[model samples]
Target: MEKDKWDKKITYPDLYLQFGSEERSFFKEEAKHLKAKYDELGSFCELKKFTGGHDYIKWNEEFVKTISKLLKT
Candidate 1:
């Protein structure tokens, strides 16, 4: 992870975080916390929670959504 470099005064880009409701509580909580931190850091962050689990299928769907958003930017 590049987290070590995050505090180096580098410009941060906007981010999107997609998670599944069916994922473990710990996972969801962690994502939410990270989203909050990013939001406080003045980053455009979107956290989407969908009805699925932490599996490849959900990841694929999120990937598609992310790509679409990127294209719109």
Candidate 2:
């Protein structure tokens, strides 16, 4: 029998969650939980924790890198 899109046996698209290492404790914990859930569902996920806080300057670099990799242009 063919499996439906919503079936547990189906794998979803890639997921990327990037956060600041110096972010708030609670937010970090939340991110951990979210990543765990996606992992449990057999999804391709990536969690990148940088050495900076919730600053745009640090996030911009990582964002550009990730986008470049995805675009592959």
Best by lDDT: 2
Instruction: Give the per-residue lDDT of model 1 (tens digit) for 1-73.
Output: 2353344255468777888889999889878877776776777778888888898888888889899978999
lDDT of each residue in 1-73, candidate 2, tens digit only: 1232344687777877788989998768867876776787888888999997898988899989998999996
Q: Tell how far residue 36 is off in model 1, in angstroms.
A: 0.9
- TM for every model, in the order presented, reads 0.76, 0.76
Candidates in order: C-alpha RMSD to true structure: 3.2, 6.4
Q: Any idea what lDDT model 2 has?
A: 0.79
Evaluate residue 55 in candidate 1 and report its C-alpha lDDT on the 0 to 100 scale: 83
- The whole-model lDDT of each prediction reads 0.78, 0.79
